[model samples]
Target chain A: MILTVTLNAALDITYHVPRLQPHTTHRVGEVVERPGGKGLNVARVLAALGHDTVATGLVGGRTGEALRAHLAAAAPGVVDALVPVGGETRRTIAVVDGESGDATMFNEPGPTVSAQEWAHFQDAYRELLIDAHVVALCGSLPPGLPVGSYAELVRTARSAGVHVLLDTSGEPLRRGIAARPDVIKPNAEELARLTGLTEPLRAAHEARRRGAYAVVASNGPQGLLAVTDEGTWRAAPPARFEGNPTGAGDAAVAGLLSALVEGLPWPERLARAAALSAATVLAPAAGEFDGAAYERLLPQIDTLP
Target chain B: MILTVTLNAALDITYHVPRLQPHTTHRVGEVVERPGGKGLNVARVLAALGHDTVATGLVGGRTGEALRAHLAAAAPGVVDALVPVGGETRRTIAVVDGESGDATMFNEPGPTVSAQEWAHFQDAYRELLIDAHVVALCGSLPPGLPVGSYAELVRTARSAGVHVLLDTSGEPLRRGIAARPDVIKPNAEELARLTGLTEPLRAAHEARRRGAYAVVASNGPQGLLAVTDEGTWRAAPPARFEGNPTGAGDAAVAGLLSALVEGLPWPERLARAAALSAATVLAPAAGEFDGAAYERLLPQIDTLP
Candidate 1:
């Protein structure tokens, strides 16, 4: 079973407005809500791909309840190992302009987890790690959690003999890479922030050098680049697709983790990751891939050495 | 006892952002949530002012639970007699720009009430009406509810010998007024839409002609105008106090109801209502009146004969 952890899971809301004008009241035409976070999104795809997955994190207040309810409805097969916290979980709003299809987002800073809550989560994560073949530590750490929380999670997963994929940015990534996780997935922007390199190849190489066993960098529509212990490979998309890009990186992470669990070669993993990432862009909303698109293009992605 | 009905209640959420830009994400600095709707706001102010009040409406799903929890925490004295429905209650978001103090609002159209849910609410309202002295039917009717629902509520309150005050807009206001509610409060623009008169005093008089025993119209900083069976009067604010005007009208409703329940004269009622309205503008956030501001301006408001 794969264990995905979202420290800052959110109740994602999308409000459809005719036009977005500043300093005016809007009558939203439609409202769509879903459970969201990088790890949750990854777990959603993983479950859809017929993988046994358990999602564990800190959930609290009414928003947390809503997130749990949605998770139950959206992915009934996936196990929910979420622990409780004191503060209300946060919500993120995406006000999508109906005319332009552009979205403006207002994201609430997630609840501050108490030190006690952090300890409780650690116990739960350690227990879940016992049965996990692979673990994915995803998203930013919420307030009150140590900056090296992801690093600690990586270490714990490693101690359990699980292949862990750490997907994050900034300080957490910098500290986590040092723990030598089995893999790390960073988009081009995050790669530059971490390795201070503009190029994906150099950034991934530099990231691997920092102790990551494997480094995968997603470069948007251009596709994915990977530097693994076996070899380095690149997978480029056949065409460009433009839509909501919010979940593309999470989809790539899902692809890489799925391939790792399947014991696929680096080239095959890179190809699937790139194609799935692009296919997610064509899906109607975030965190979902178009099966038809995925099937048609799955065989078209060409991996290069 | 005062019973305030908010058929289309919402979980009001305010997010403070440093600045707002289209198509960009904002990290909210603060998040404030409250149970809201015109009637709920009125109930809150009433409870704060030491009145016995009960808030009733339709609430369901996680948002509804949160709203009830907040109401319980904020006003323990106020009775929450809200009924349940099948759909999830809606949320309204106010994106407040920290630098400018300007807010952009996005309001969700509340849950669509099933026919069965509407019948269930009627039963609850009928039972509550027996113990109520005054009933305020407030805000928009949620979708799937009959447009004449407020009219029916006004008649029910009247049958129970309870004075009814109706505050709404458009067709709901039109149908509700024919029930001869003891009072009807409409803002300047809503009055213009309902009576086709841009002039405040003229609109108030015309609204009274439609069967409301009294008609009150809020005219922004200018204050309130009233046309009652006793006479026509205008209560002007002492001065303009600008802030979040979201709950000014609700505060005015609270003041008028407090005065009505006390059997105060029209002039005094208008003065208190106008003073409370201005005081609410001076108060931070919504549904609150600054006591000092209300005290300082109450005696100063000049009621024109």
Candidate 2:
């Protein structure tokens, strides 16, 4: 079973307006809500692709209940093992401009997790890992949790003989890589921030040397660059899909984890990651992909060594 | 007992950010939520001033539940007679720029009340009016309700021998005034929209001639201009208070109702309304007043003949 953890899950709300203007009143025409978090996004994509996935995170208050309800209704295939906390789960609002398709985001600070809650989550995670083959620690740590949260989770998964993928940024990612997760997927900007290298291949190699067994760096529209012990490869889709790119990276993570669990080669894994990500950009909402596009783009991906 | 009705109530959420720039994301530093709708605001202020006030309106779903929980905690003095509906309650967000103290508003269209729900509310309204000395019908008509909703409520209150105050704008106010409510409060803009007259005294007189026995026109920082059957008076605070004016009008409504219930003359009522309104502006959040300021400004109000 594949396990994904989102320490700071959110109830994502999208408000559609004719046009967005700052410091002016807007009467939203439509409102769309979904359960959101990096781990939840990846888990949904994996489950949709016929993989057995479990999602665990800390949720609390009425907002948490609403997020759980939305998850159950939206992704029935994924098992939920979320722990409850004291504070209300935060909400993230994306005001989408109907004309330009641009999004203005407002993120509420998520709930502060208590010591007991954090301890409880660690125990719950350990239990989930007992039956898990691979685990993905995703997103930022909510307030009150130590900055080394992802690092600790990486070590736990490694000790349990489960493959772990660390996908985060800044201090958490920096500290997490030191714990030597099996894989780390950072976009070009995150790669630069982590290794201070502008070139993708150089940065991916630096990240791998730091701790990860393999490093896959996303180069936005250009696609995926992978540096592994076996070999180095660059994978790109035949054509770039233009739409919302909100959850495209999460799709890449899901593809990588799914391919790894299936024991695919590094080149094949990159192809899968690039294709799934390109397909996700064509989707209207985040955490969703166009299945037909994914299937069509799979073989059209160019994988070069 | 004073009964206040908010047909289209809201969970008002305020987000404080350092600055508001168009097309850019904002990380809100503080989030303050309140149970809002003009009538509810009036009820809260009235209760705060030791008046027996009952708050009634439509609320539904999880957002409504949150609003109710907040109301129960914030205004324990006000009795809750709010009726439940099938649709989720709407939320209004005010993103306040800390730099300029300006607010950008986004209003979600509230739940549409079905015919059955409207009927249930009317029955509940009639029952509540039995023990009420005065009633205030406030705010907009949510979708799926007749535009003459306030008009119908005005007639119902009149039939129950309850003094009714209409405080709304646009077509509802136009239609509601013809029902001959005892009093009507219209802000400068709302007055112009209703009577198409920019002058406060002329517009107030025009509104009174249509159906209202009295008309109280709020002239922004200038204070209150009242036209009634007995006479006309203009009331102003000793000094203008500069602060948030979000709920100043609702505080004015509360003051007017409290004085009317006590059988105070028109001049005394205007003084109470103006002072309370001014004090509300000095408070940080809406539906609240600076008690010390309210007390200090009350006797200092100048009522002109």
Candidate 3:
């Protein structure tokens, strides 16, 4: 089973309105809600693609219950082993102005994790890691959690023989990479912050040398760039997608993790990851890919090494 | 006992932010949540002022649970006799940008009530009306509900010997007035829309002639105008209050209801309503009337007949 951890899971609400005028009233025409966070995003895709996935994270209060209910109904295959906490789960509102087709996001800070909650998460994670072939530690650390939280997760997963993948930014990513996760996936900006290099390939190489076995970096429309012991590769989709690109990154992580579990070659893995990500951009819900879109774009992907 | 019905109640979420910019993510500084809707807002103030207020309406799902929890914790004196439905309660977001001191509101459409749910609400409303001295039917009717829903509610309350006060707009208010609710409060725009008269006093008289026992019109900073069977009166606060006026109307309803139960004269009722409405503007939360501000402004109010 593949384990995905979202330390700061959210109840994502999308409000559709005709237009969004700042400091004015907007009567939303439609409201769509779902469970969200980087790890949950990845787990959702993996489950949709028929991967055996378990999603574990901190969840509390009524918002947490709503998130759990949504996840169950939306992604039935993904087992929820969430750790209970004291504080309420956070919510992210994306007000989509239908006229402009632009989204304005208001993010609520996730619940403060008490010391006891953190300890509970550690024990729960260790138990989950024992049955996992691969584990993906994803998203921001909630308040009251140390900056090295992901690093601790990575080290623990590795100690239990679970191949750990770290996908985050800032101190958590920096510290997690130092713990030598099997894989580290960063977008162009996050990669630059990690290695201080503007060029994707060069930055991925620097990132790999910093302790990760393989470094995969996303360059927006340019697609995936990777550096590993096996070889270096670049993968691009057939065409560009100009829709909501909110969860495309997480879809790429799911593709990479899924391919790794299946023992696919590096080039094939990149092609799959790139195709899934491009397909996700065409989907209405953030981080979800259309199956037909992915299948159609799979062979058309340009995989060069 | 004062019974207030919020047909379309909400979980009001207030987000305090440094600044509000379109199409950007805002990290909220603080979050204050309360159970809201016009009737709930009225019930809150009545309870604060030591009135035996019973609040009833439709609520369901996890969001509904959160609303109940908040109401229990914040307004313990206000009895929650709310009806349970199948759909989750809606939420309204008020983003207060600290820099400009302006609020941007995003109101979610409340749950769609099935016929069964509407019937349940009717049963609950009838039970509460039995012991009520006054009943307030407030706010808009949610979708899937007929436009004449409030008219039925008004007629039912009148038949039960409960004095009904209505505060709404558009087709709902127009139909509700035909049932002759004891009092109908409309702001300038609503009054104009109802009577098709640009003049407030003229429209108030026209509204009363159309079967309403009394017509109370709010003319923004000018305070309230009343045309009742007793007499016509104008009540103004000591001075203009330039602040959030989202729930000032609800506060006025609370004030009017409170004085009416005490058998106060029209002049005194109008004075209390105007003072409470003005004090609401000075308070942080929409419906909360500032005790100090209300006390300070009470003696200075200009009440004329």
Compose the digit string of candidate 3's lDDT tens values, residues B75-191.
Answer: 999999999888878999999899898899999899999988898889888988889999999998888899999999999999999999999999999999999999999998999
Clashing pairs in 2: none
RMSD (Cα, Å) of model 1: 1.4
Q: TM-scores across all candidates? A: 0.98, 0.98, 0.98
Task: Candidate 3: give the clashing pairs.
Answer: none
DockQ values of all predictions: 0.90, 0.76, 0.84
* Candidate 1 local distance difference test against the native: 0.90
Report backbone clashes per prediction.
0, 0, 0
What is candidate 2's CAPRI-style docking category based on DockQ? medium
The true-versus-predicted C-alpha distance at residue B299 of model 2, in Å, is 0.7
Which candidate model has the greater lDDT, 1 or 2?
2
Residues A134-200 of candidate 1 have per-residue lDDT tens digits of: 9999998888889999999999999889999999999999999999999999888999999989988
Give the Å error, residue B294, model 3.
1.5
Best prediction by DockQ: 1
Model 2: per-residue lDDT, tens digit, A4-94?
9999999999898998877789997787889999999999999999999999999999999999999999999999999999998889888
Interface RMSD of 2: 1.1
Which candidate would rank higher by DockQ, 1 or 2?
A: 1
TM-score of 2: 0.98
